[model samples]
Target: MTEPSTMLAIDPAAPGGPEVLVPVERPVPTPEPGEVLVRVRAAGVNRPDVLQRMGLYPMPPNAPTIMGLEIAGEIVAVGQGVARPEVGDKVCALLAGGGYAQYAAVPAGQCLPIPQGLSFVEAASLPETYFTVWSNLFERAFATEGDTVLVHGGTSGIGVTAILLAKAFGLRVIVTCGSDEKCAAARALGADVAINYNAGDFAELAREANGGRGVDVVLDMVGGDYVPKNIALLADEGRHVSIAFQRGPRADLDLSQVMRKRLILSGSMLRPRTVAYKSALADSLVRDVWPLFAQGKLRAIIDSTFPLADAAEAHRRMEAGEHVGKIVLEVP
Candidate 1:
């Protein structure tokens, strides 16, 4: 391996806008116990990364933190006691933080072999969204075959992935998107019903489509005004899992509605979870979902890729709500 004193990365000194993100050279990290030093081939751009950059989601009391949550790379060096993945293994990891760099240290257990027939760019897009969906929607929400699921952001990377995976598991999917074209895109991606949230009431549409039974589950990212509507749209014993709040988090809840429906309200953030816990989520994905991906039955939805130096542009696109799938940064 070539020795380099520093790595090129996107850094945010003060968070306000996309312009705040600037390229910088930072010291390369070394792997600690149970970790592997990865030569990053690509890193995924996610909403959380943007939030972290703006100081909304601070970096665990650590300043000057590198921004990223998932990466695809080759294991260039392994720390002591790590045996399964040796040097030169191509993998993707669910990072706690610090994925936007030429090299980043990741826990060995959080790494998974890249799915067969996937490029580094595609692999980089899977870890964060897939892990969050599996853990929250399937595991926590008890979403099962024959159930009906309402995904709030149909054109999004998470929404598309949820629709596909839910369909793969024999579940019915309804998604909400901003435009008719985007709605059509969601339908083409396996959404049973694509409602234009700008023009239609998704709660009513989803309910009508389900024959007034209401959806069995809702995977929500828009949290403000949608909260009550979410409660109204759920079937008895239904589950609502929120992974983000694009509309803001403060909302009034009606306890009576929650009681009447017997719904489960839950939220999960993948980054703050323990390595061991996240490793288990990764294991389940490898065991259950990897086969489908390998068979070409399920794959990632990539919206765009930008050079690492153009991260600010990537964040701008994301904030504009113009992107439909995952945005990525090419390391080389």
Candidate 2:
């Protein structure tokens, strides 16, 4: 089969609002050694994409200027060293960049076979959020069954995945969302308690939900002022894993509480990690979490989808923060 010469891609002509994400035709990229060329079917929209569009999250050196981090597609061509994902295999990949196009050159190790019974749209939503949650919440924080976890942004892609996975693994989950509707959505997704952050203090509610001992783990995406509140919400020797700082990056915290409580504060950024590290994470996810999908214990929550040409509108919806779960862009 012959590959196309050009494909449509979303490019942020100038760093600004969603309207800047303009569609343009560009030459299809070739796979490098250890990579594969994917015929993209769907690409997941993430907060990082919004940050990238604002010029705050610059593309890593040597990555494509296009803005997408995860995609579900068919492998059309394989690079020399890649042998496992043969041509025609459908896969969802954790891409460092370039998933916004109709064709993407992705490292083979970052690709996972789409789980049984999952559509391309569902698979597309998996990589970025799952990888981040697994790497940080499970691996780094050492979260386990019988423990209590407090998740912020409960209706978000990452928060929802964390809630489902934590519940499936027998952990009690508490979440905070901005509205009552989102709070209800989080509860329906198996969160033990959902607090409307706008209505009340999440730290106090989380503690009450955990029987006054505070939670065993906290998955925080809202940083800044949330840092102090998150620290206050943790149990003795509890872990705080931050994946984003949508509120702001700077924080003023009291160290006395951290010391007395034996709290562990840590965070990670997924895009800049080495291929070997990400590949290992992919392997771990397949072995541990993929089976949960087959059993219906885990599922993707899609809020909306748009054609590739209307990616600008998709970004606008995401920026509004009114939608729950994941938003995706369909290649066709």
Candidate 3:
């Protein structure tokens, strides 16, 4: 079947609030070399997408201005040298941009087969969070079996994925949520302990919950004041991986403590990375993470889903911070 000349997309014209995300007509993109044209079934909404909508996150050079980072769809066309994932193959892809549209041109190597028995929305939720946690928690922090990890935002997409990965890998996990309900939700999802961050000192609570040994790793998305507390919670030679700074970016650190504890502080931003680098991450996910999804050992925690035209409402839901997991947009 011939593709349409245009498709609906939520690309804001200017930096502003959720009200700016209005559906607009955009030309259907053709597959570039080493790429595939996917008829997007769904796209995942992330914190970065919120920031992008507000104009706080800058688009990488030559990237599509349309807003989205991950999408799940079916391959409709393939560019040169793309021997695998022929027409009609179902895939979920990580994109630097352009995922919010009905159609997306994705790098071939950045595409992963949708796991058996998973919907497009579930598959759509995997790329961004899975790639992030796998890269930082396991690859960068080298979190191995028997380690204890403290994950902030227990009910969030990243936090939930961390809990599941920790459980599947034999690690003890403690998570923090804003409310008792989310705490229970986290525990039900296999977290060893879930603390309500608003009730008391999360560092103390997490430590006590972990039997007072302190955590071997801390996966922090909240920066600023939490930085010192996070450092204090780390055991000797502990690793701290920062993925986002919702509170604020700048943090005060104690160099002496860092030196004495032999702690490592590191973080990474995914959007600005090269296609070759992200492709490598996709390969790693296929080897180490995709099987867990295929076997039903891991599942994406979907909080809510909206139609493609309701993209504005989806952003509002995310910004409200009440949702328990990923918010997805189903393409019409």
Cα RMSD (Å) per model?
A: 1.4, 0.8, 0.9
For residues 14-108, could you state the per-residue lDDT of candidate 1 as single tens digits? Answer: 78788877788999888888989899999999888888877789565432388888999999888888996789999999887888889888988
- Tell me how far the alpha carbon of residue 136 in candidate 3 is from the true structure, in angstroms, after superposition: 0.5
- Go through the candidates in order and give each one's C-alpha lDDT: 0.87, 0.92, 0.92
Clashing pairs in 2: none
lDDT by residue for model 2 over 164-280, one digit each (tens)? 889889999899999999999999999999999988788987787777888889888999999999998888999998889988998998899899999999999999999999999
Poorest 10 consecutive residues by lDDT, candidate 1: 58-67
The lowest-lDDT stretch of 10 consecutive residues in candidate 2 is 205-214
Stretches off by above 4 angstroms in model 3 are none
Q: Which regions in candidate 1 have their CA more than 4 angstroms from the true location?
A: 61-64
TM-score comparison, 1 vs 3, better candidate: 3
Ranking by lDDT: 3, 2, 1
What is the Å distance of residue 240 in model 1 from its true position? 1.2
